[model samples]
Target: MDDSLIIYVVASMVTVMAISCWRRRCQKSLAPVPSGYGKVFKSHLFGKPTIVSTDPEVSKFILQSVSEDFVPFFPGSLTELVGKSSILVINGSLQRRVHGLIGSFFKSPILKAHITADMQRDLQEIMASWRDDQIVYIQEEAKYMVFQIMVKTLIGLGPGEHLQFLRHQYQKFVAGIISIPVKIPGTRFYRSLQAKKRMMKLVKYIIQEKKKNNTGCISRDIIDAFLNDGSGQLTDDLILDNVIDLMIPAEDSVPVLITLAIKYLSDCPLVLQKLKEENTKLKHKSLEGEDLQWMDYMSLSFTQNVISETLRMGNIIPAVMRKAIKDVEVKDHFIPEGWCVLPYFRSVHLDKEIYDDAYKFNPWRWKDKDTAASSFTPFGGGQRLCPGIDLSRLIASIFLHHLVTGFTWVAEEDHMVNFPTVRMQRNMPIKVKRKNIDILLS
Candidate 1:
């Protein structure tokens, strides 16, 4: 046999052997884990991304105790898009300072003062557009209303025709955010860039005009804080980046949480009724500034329960991703340095051992009958948990307070809502039965 032929044959066998080993490894991953606990098993189909660690102790360590050793595992596309300085991409003290800034903006009195009027206005506009007793796509409507809320508060877009035009472009800009790399024609990335440019142009022009005139126009909110110091530490460029950071995600999360709340709340008529009564009480109070705080004591039990239950059942940020800072061990499994970590929230939220009736949709589970805020955490847990939890809670409270008070909900036939925990949502629709103010009182 010739030497070259022998070498080729040897190489071919090595390739075949390697392929065999890979196939065997894939098959092993498909096998199930120890029975009757969480499905803390592995499968390579979705890149073997399932959480093999559902233990709360383990979760506590990763989510709370040891955040120093991990940083976010942003989607490769997002990493390329958001860069590394924005709050979502950084680590250590820089993360703290930046998040502190975000936290300051989201603080209770500030956000309530900022968004209450806009929130009420946006809700009214959304409701007015709906035909009486219509079964619209709540998901789409919710998305639109949230977008309006984001704009009305983040900018000073008041009720007018111009507000609508600006909102459309803002929507276009947000839609482009998930676009990354290969910015060619017909691509999401290229389209997003165009959207970004248009948005900055419009917003910058507004800011510049305000600066030029010294219109004595303070936003009285975030956009206000950002604008008052116009071109200081909060430069136009930084404000625009912050716009992307806050508005895009803010726009998306509201609709999602609202949709989930509707799906969950529609089923429990008593819960709905309680909310309605609570809401009815609001009609007597002013809908602005400090008056919104009246919601603090109204149906406190039921409100808290509904919010908690919705969060638990829904999977918004299903599996949070973090890059391991160093080698870590759980049991016998060794995840080496640079490997990604996903503290899968869904698995933990529904773990049979943790939640008694893991599949049952129950809000009473979260009622603080005594004191401690139980095992319920939809806003995430630990040091790096979502900074917007308070603001999100406030937004949710604003929407739900009105929803429970202002309207009633029923399932739409054939277009019924369903839950599947794989992704962060359950695509569902409900027929909102608008309430007459008289009947809710008695």
Candidate 2:
């Protein structure tokens, strides 16, 4: 009956009640409307009539629909920040043209090799800076490392003044991605727009320089891909818009994926041990001091499974947004013209009926499963599948290889937040110590 004890009990009760209320609210929002559409619901969202589908078949149909039927739809804040001409927003022939030019380059062997070397070298450099029992904020390290690699790939820039400046501006630009759409001074959106102008000014200079020096020559970076296209369809503004757009995924999803994998692995000791063993065996096979090739990394079957599981659970991109260009019916569900249609991938991914022990992180389950199945669309689907999917996977695979083989770490208290974006609450802090290679290999 002490006063302090009474206060503590009351606070606990309040917290429980708050959590219960939040859950109930979420359930109510997700529940189908009075039309009894089950997995499909009609609701007003983002100031428009919307059809939100959690059914995999319906979701797949919408994603695979032709551009004439459904096109990319983003919020006002995102559209303004991403630009009007970005590959993210453009549709039909223009979008296809850009997608073709970039997709081929993104999947080329040269690019893959470059990414592997850069990721390994940069990861090694960062890991080397870690001291024994140091509490490394992996979110920061992952961002630093991934951002540098992405900049190099995009513009062929290395560690120097230019990269640093872009990194600084990029942080401001990203801050406004989900901010209120006000362009006044001191606002997140305004700062983001200003930051973008600065970054684009630098990129424009780089493009001008590239045009002068490279011309028709094949440069390994993305700029080269744009420059060397014989079609003559791309303008400087389009290239600039797409470059800034591409940088969004670099700063957002890839680093988060790496951080999430580390977070999940830290919590699941058995899975971590198995993953480490797989990568360690690969390490043992390559003892000549030669850098591991892209194939070498890709061939790690179990490592790939872990990446698959991470993508499934991570759901870095929780939904695909599109506006119906015309009235359409998906799996007997009617979608009105010009309405926002969202295929909620997160709901499907976490469905208990689809994945056994759905909420659990189990990489082994992927061993017998087909990642190409409709149930697994982490990178979206159809022609709009993320072009950087391979690159993202390869980067993560290499990072995990080096991380598990070269060091040991204990993750600090942290949790993953899914809404807005999937990110670690505490920047995924971990105390890591270098592992002796001699002992580890043996």
Candidate 3:
């Protein structure tokens, strides 16, 4: 045989072997496990080996008892984009201090008042823009409305060129949170990084303006609150990171939940009927006409149930990633230090043992079950639980109140997809019509 031919044959063999090995590894990463394999399982995701837990007990332990042993594990792309000081990835004293500062504000009476006033005004404006029989993209409209509300509530931003510019930059920045980490020009990561830089600059300007305009008194909005913080714990970077962290979820997750709630209501007419009945009664009982009060939202039982069911089914945040800082063992599974552990939240939400007809969209199931039980952790659990839970629920309830009370919509999309995020394939277009004005009042 010729030397050239022999060399070509050897190269071909090597290529085949490499391809075979890669394929096998990919299969192992994605393979389905047997029923008896304990709650914890080892798997590979995106070519990186990690441990995943579907056990609620283990999840609770990791999120609460052993929280110090594991820290949030963000992809290289996300850490670079969100910055190092973001509360989402930080731990220890810094996390607590940041959390205490922000948490106090979020839970304060002033912020709640602001949220109520802002959400009502913004929601009313958004609803007013919808003409009878108009085809509205639920996801797009919800995102715009929620983003506006979040900006106004969090940073005191209002309709203007700056808001528009920031909105555009934010859309780009969040789009790359899950993309490849390559920094080459024109890549998603590159665009996202550029967008992040613009956003940070904008935030810095806002912070400086807030500081310059500070009155000795405390302020209602988050930016003003941080600026007036006397402890000196809040650095510019810390303020920017936490604000961006909060904004990303407010922009992405909450809107998705709102859209999903609309989608579910459209598909499940019985649930919609119950929600409408509940909200309509409240609408008629409102002594202060034309606006909903904080108390009114709190009294919405069936409507809240629908929101809970929507969250459970939507699974907007499907899983949370954590890295083990120390070796841990739960049940029979041993997780070593430096390994990544993922708590598959969707698994628990959809577990057959916990929920009857788990695959079905049944809001009534929540009527008898304990909605706050650990089994349902859509907002997560323990110390790191989303501090915005009350705010998120309030937003959902307010939107549902307006929607069910004033308008009726029909779903234009037949399906929703959940991968990187839960969203309708066609953005969930809906044809909305105004309900009888008299009926809304009655």
Candidate 4:
């Protein structure tokens, strides 16, 4: 072939490839809906037409309506990574059975006891490592702390090289859960797939070990609870998938909330003062060296408000996806069967009509409002309401209680970005100082 002809051919191919890539990028872009499109607007996600809603009433209909018209619909990357048997991806009878087997475990008093002990010890250890004037990334440290609590309390796995390894792999897995679904070398999806395999192996080993030592009676830990139930309702694969699903979200969402709480408290000193006062008074009420009880956490009205406000602003779960099982009309918007429906909780959380000064960090706004209302759904709603809601709150509250009462911190940088999940751009670095005895005694 002539050299000129070859060069022309290469140029043409390059141009074609460039256009293809640009179109792919545009296909993934989700620009804000223009005004006059109503509360619900149609958009395309990965080439499929989807309905996106920012209305709380529409969100309620999609999440709670009992017509069997909609079911959970995760992205392709998540569906592949979480596995078919995962409770997050499955629906109908299996979901109920899986929920039945594990739901009680999450709500059990024994489980709460385990989490309390684990969280206190872990938080103390983490805080002890911080020194006055030292800079620490709260998001990174919070992830480590939350992951440790979940592993130890849920799977009965103690701190070790194995636990650390799983945490590392799980982090990578989560990073890839929402990436583009290509499996080519060096792609996030490919790495996530590898991480998923490693995590599954670790979880399977833990499950087998528990089964070997089972006494056929329910135990405080989730693994033993499933094994001892002996109903055989959950196969090993199902158990492993659900465990991964639960751990991935627990590791990310709670830590994001914790880190955001730190940011908000630092940004709003008056709110911090109120939070500190509430927590400090509780600390004074405790008998010397006595650990806090679950009731103690429950009574933290201001601290709980801080968490609610952080959840609202943080928007850890920006949206929940569901696919219509049949043709459904929500608020006069037609949604065809098989089309994706996204109830954007973040939109509702930030809606000016729903929240005053919606962008500002204000815990006081929650004082007079019902925090459990549908407008706030960081834990989601309906039958899929997070089984770990109470536990998540407990974890955040314990961490906040210890943090506000035990230390003083100033945010070095406070900027957050939310795409796959809400996270700090700088991982929320902060300078730390231990409170003096006089401050604690006061």
Candidate 5:
């Protein structure tokens, strides 16, 4: 080989090797891509092939399915924990019936009034225990208050041994919601199942007692609502499982929503001031010894905007899962039959293209925005949508009303933890002091 010929041969060899190496690197990088690309993609989630969608239109389609194309589904551990017979697991006509029975009662004006009163009383009691300059953990406090109110609303229990026992067992039950599916002895799943059993026994006893004491009265609470159902279709198991379902949010999403709102308000002073100003007007209107009605709280436009923005940024529920009963194609993304489909609300909520300055905590953005749009799914969307949406909003609004109106607080250093669940790193500590408005309320 001459010098020129050798140089050409060596350069060609080197170029080929570099190309091969680059090909291998690209293949390696693409190997474990969960979901392919774009707003809709495919992945294996919790051991099942899943179609993950961040597109609002596809999400709306999946959530609004009335046919067999999609059905409510959860991970194995969650399905087992909540039980196969849970309202969450059941589908079609039966699920609708149960949902309607509970949802109708939950949405009735009578229940709303009662819920507002219960929330106010519980919040006031919780806030009363806070002293000036005290560093209160807002997460824990909100959880305590929300749980008590939920207990009262569900089974009409109020601050006693029964309530205490249920709360203790509930902690154990909730611990396994996202754990491995194994139910062996000493496992979190096993303990949670046992907790559910204990909770069921107590709840059964309470139901019987409530039934026995009934004097043909109107429904006073959810227990009464269940008992008064003329359909005769609501069995003991149905009621027990569904009541447990309701408690999940009471301990998780609802409190977390309130906590996140507080965190956001703590970070956004101008937004907090506007919320306080709006709520303070309602506060003054209630100063004549009148309890604020359900409408009074919901009618607070700015407060609702703050709640909307908080939910937009918080993404408490984040994503919801469904099982495809049939192979479906959404916007060129194909979901195989029986595959899990997750509509990731968090993505859409935080997508900059969808919302200008999406990362910023700007409540004013919601002032003229369309909250009913497909992009927002804080409490979820469609038929299986959270029945407690109104109730949760009512609770948060009432809490903010009282907190911002009667007191001032400086939040301790904390940041949001999004994965595994949305929660505060330090449970959102705040040093609070009573404001001048407290005296007027007193």
Candidate 6:
């Protein structure tokens, strides 16, 4: 054979070897959801992305107790994509302390102040176009508005224009975490990386400025407080990542969740009108920091139930994924030392064993307070059970309180909405009846 033939053969062999190794790594050890994820494949060698852990107790062992065994949540693909700045990747004793300091920022007053103003104002701005009876892309709108909410409340209301510009990049930065590592031209990873770089540059610059100026306002938002206070407990990198990470879904949670609730109420119009009536008595004077400090003030029976019900039905993430760190047993199955497991939250959310008319949307299910806690945990559960749970609830409630009590929101899309298709699939295109708005506080 000629020398050219030999070189070509050698090159082909190396390419094949690389491909084989990549496949083996992904199959033997799960990687991550690719960036710009189109559709997930359920199985390793099969058609769709299959749910690995079918049983709940199996999920519990991995997600909860077996933390000692697993590597926390470091997937090579996502880590390279997100880098190490994210708190979601930060594990061990140090993470515990960051959680503590960050926890302080979510005070009752701070949250209440956020809900009444920041959350409400942003939503109104996004929906103001609806006053013209314009057809708005709610899914995309939710994505944008929520991104802003996350930015302002989690960071600080500094520069709106810069925030949104940076936020657009930040969201891209976030989406990059799940992207394929192909950094060629027009690749998701390339775009994502560029976005992350843009964000980091901006955040680092701002942190330096604030430090130089001596704002002494680190306690203003979760990011500031985490980096500055509590015995210098958290690192600056962790603070920046957490700032961006936690800001995600600021509006998505409420809007997608509210959209879900609207669907439920659509099928049961009586419930819709009933909720409006209950909120009729509420003053639109706005919830303040003081009011939020006391959780019970806004914990109206009807309001809480509606928000809680939305959470139950809208367990957004299907299952929390975790791998076993050591030998663990669950429901007669030993989820060996290295196997991954997925705790399908949808199953728990609709488990016939736990709920009545499991498929039905019943806000009253949560009216009884303690009875509702067991049936719902849209955020999550246990030690890592969303520290921002209270604030999330407060935000959702305030939004819903404003929504149902104020203008009429109708589906601009088809009759029954889609679900399981993708993120917030069930959400319908809704238009606001702004002229018919009811000013409750007057």
- Compose the digit string of candidate 1's lDDT tens values, residues 1-442: 4323533565456446534544444335322222223333332211324334445555555666454677766655456555445567767765665566666666646556656666776777777666657776666776666766666666666667766666666566555554344567666655666766667677777667656865555444455656664334445666666655676655566677777777766666766766665555665454333455624633356666676677777766665666667776554444556666555566777878777798787776665432123344456666666777656666677777776666666666423222211222334555677777667545
- Candidate 2's displacement at residue 308, Å, is 1.0
Cα lDDT tens digits for candidate 5, 55-112: 8999999999874889887877799889776888888888888788778877889888
TM-score of 5: 0.89
Taken over the whole model, the C-alpha lDDT of each candidate is 0.59, 0.85, 0.79, 0.80, 0.83, 0.58
What TM-score, computed on C-alpha atoms, does each candidate reach?
A: 0.76, 0.92, 0.89, 0.89, 0.89, 0.77
lDDT of 4 by residue, 256-346 (tens): 8898899888889899999999998888866377777776887799888898899898888888888888988766667787888889898
Clashes in model 4: which pairs? none
Model 3 Cα lDDT, one tens digit per residue, 334-393: 677888878888888999998889989988898898877878889887778888887888
Residue 78 C-alpha lDDT in model 2 = 89
What ranges in model 6 sit over 4 Å off? 1-58, 74-76, 121-129, 215-218, 230-233, 251-254, 284-297, 369-375, 414-427, 435-442
Candidate 5, pairs of clashing residues = 35-42
lDDT for position 355 in model 3: 88
lDDT of 4 at 143: 85
Which stretches of candidate 3 lie above 4 Å from their native place?
1-36, 287-291
Q: TM-score of predicted model 6? A: 0.77
Highest TM-score: which candidate?
2
RMSD of each: 8.9, 6.2, 7.0, 6.8, 10.5, 9.0
Q: Candidate 4, after superposition: displacement of residue 91 in Å?
A: 0.7
Q: Give the lowest summed-lDDT range of ten residues in model 5.
A: 26-35
lDDT for each residue of candidate 6 in 173-239, tens digit (9 for 90 to 100): 6555544466765666678778877887777777776677656654665656655675765567776
Which window of ten consecutive residues has the lowest lDDT sum in model 6? 38-47
